[model samples]
Target: MEAMPHDPAKPEFTPLDVPPGGLETPYGILYRPLASGLQILVLFAAFIGGPAFAWVIGQVPGDLSQTARDVLFVPMVAIFFLGYGLWIARLNAIAFHGIGLGLLKALFKLIVFRRKPESVADFIPSRDKLLEMMVRAQQAGSSFAPVGWLVGVIAGLTAMLFDSALHPAKLFLLVGGGCVIWAHLLAWLGRRNWLPFMESE
Candidate 1:
């Protein structure tokens, strides 16, 4: 028997069917799960006395022993890599799942309607309403952790880079935050856009 066709507007994916390991990417990649966390660590590790470490590194006491210098430098190196790696990985996720897919959806819509645009407007949702939507996505067996682990990393990066290059870390945090937010947004846009890996198509 011949197989039945699929519908694009209403993709086979639904919040209830989101993969247990991670999200479905816009492309065929095995995307990571969407979530956030580790607030207190981010708070103290990145802020508070974090700036002091950079300052200590910057104006090291001329008489201090080489051993003292090594101690300060090691963690800085570790933080530098950890902070940078997470932020970059987060960006890759966003590029593939968020921005890239969003563009694809726009293209799909344009091709379908000749750019006339379909009207799907509604009133702006209140904070509570938005929170409720997140809850709903979770209730449907979808993974939706709203805590960002990058916060502490970004904070650590901020303290370390306060004297040199602050912008990179801040930019990374912004991009990462935007990425997570876009993932949250998928609770609404996922099924509508025929996203890849979402339905095993």
Candidate 2:
């Protein structure tokens, strides 16, 4: 034992294997990468776009008295949920239980995406086309992610209209359900034509 040599460079050499049904970042509990990345983008757009949109909401020079915060935050939350569910589909290699865990993790981390500079920074690298390919390899739904964001924005606005009586519950039910249904629909439509090589290992 006393004669054992230490290798500083190889410190602990941990394998980068995601657990059978779990995920962790060096920072701690994370979702599958593509989903994580999409959530991060939604977070990024929200923080960057939220305040400005909020200001516009207040300044539109009309009877519209709503705060800019709602204008920004609603879409942010909506898209995040949609993106999150589709992201879960990517991890289908994992058990359904694991996917649920991943989805829950994504929901929990929703707030984490709000922490400034870091949030914005995360989105920048995800713009790489190669990164999308990598995400696809993992079975994450990159194809519909953009459309998911659009659908999320629409759903968010719709929720806002019904907010007075519905509050947050409506948003959750509608957005979450829509994401699941649309994702499955898209998957089905693409099934016949989808290139199998695009699937993950």
Candidate 3:
């Protein structure tokens, strides 16, 4: 007897029949390898580009008017922070899933002395499912908590650097206070189980 070739367009078997690395999401085929490479590229670009851009801006000729300089400078600064926010949010998500939550739980147990702190596993459904939750959370805006704080920090630093009238101490204090409030809001959302995107379908 002769054998027939497999046709992916007309899948004859269940999803389990699909091999590893062939998983597809609602968005499209999950190109794990390519995605990983792109993530590395993005991280490298953000970290390296910030200081490089700053240096380039500093080298700008002194002949340009203050208004013209501001036009160029302000947008570059915004771009730097935009990149910083995105990368920071991604890093925070990775840390939260990997070991950050677990470490925080242990630290709380050591300090509170009331009862054994629940494990990260208790809050999270499963390690394997975390990637999906993270993706969804990122889409839903919950994962950008770190981004907001990073932007605040960048804005505060920029103000201090460029505006003599602005008090550096007050700017930093305001940014720090805003970050604290944002952190608490995120914590509250997590406590209420209101992170809709993180919930399993």
Candidate 4:
């Protein structure tokens, strides 16, 4: 298998006939053309970012109130760090389940059942500037993923604060929700022919 870059100036959506590439590198069909750079970033996040974040947390003033630390780790700054870390760690699959499976279901329903599905537009915009943004992302490599992370964190945090007091469901949404937003962006890319799709000879 080999990774090949296509011209992003003119985008091509993937054809559904042959097997499509894996969403990410580890799955093995499509490789990161800039796999080396991403690998380095992963190493830095694991070795450098992970340990640094832990050390910084450890340095928090021992005399501070429990509530303060809780906010920092629970609903505030930690959420940003976590939102970022989740994407880096690729542990955010739970976020993609809804939209991912829903889109698949919609496609299957239309194809197999020979009935049009309404949920397709709900998962993605039928036509709008968002499509333009998604096209740009198709070319920009995976670096654009954080856009979803940032938005999801802000939305989740706002919900948590408005309700006040952490609830199990809200907290689940807090971390998990961010991944959902990011996953959509990934899905947009995964389906497109703009990627350097690796295929077996």
Structural similarity to truth (TM-score) of each candidate: 0.26, 0.29, 0.31, 0.24
Any runs in candidate 3 off by more than 4 Å, and if so which? Answer: 1-70, 97-99, 102-125, 133-201
Selected candidate, larger TM-score, 1 vs 3: 3
Tell me the whole-model lDDT of each prediction, alpha carbons only. 0.37, 0.42, 0.45, 0.41
Lowest summed lDDT window (length 10), candidate 3: 192-201
Q: Write the per-residue lDDT of candidate 3 for residues 106-184, one digit (tens) a residue.
A: 6777778755544435434453444454444433333334544665566446544543343667645543444434433
Q: Residue-pair clashes per candidate, as listed?
A: 8, 3, 0, 1
Better of 2 and 3 by TM-score: 3
The sequence of per-residue lDDT tens digits that candidate 1 reaches over residues 73-152 is 44333433343344344435544453456556667778897773333212233333333443332322212112223333
Candidate 3 steric clashes: 0
Ranking by lDDT: 3, 2, 4, 1
Which model scores highest in lDDT? 3
Cα lDDT tens digits, model 2, 1-201, are 587775533323334454444353333332233354554564455335434443443343233335423553454344444544555555453433333454555556666775333232233222232233333434443334465546655655554554343455555455434544444444332222221212234
What 10-residue stretch in candidate 2 is worst by lDDT?
189-198
Number of the predicted model whose TM-score against the real structure is largest = 3
Rank order (by TM-score, best first): 3, 2, 1, 4
Model 4 lDDT per residue over 28-137, tens place: 23322335566455434433432344234323334434443344334323433443454333322322342465567777877899977643354543333233333333
The better candidate by TM-score, 2 or 4, is: 2
- After the best TM-score superposition of candidate 2, give how far the Cα of residue 104 lies from its true spot, in angstroms: 25
Model 4, 61: alpha-carbon shift in Å? 6.4
Give the TM-score comparing model 3 with the true structure, all chains together.
0.31
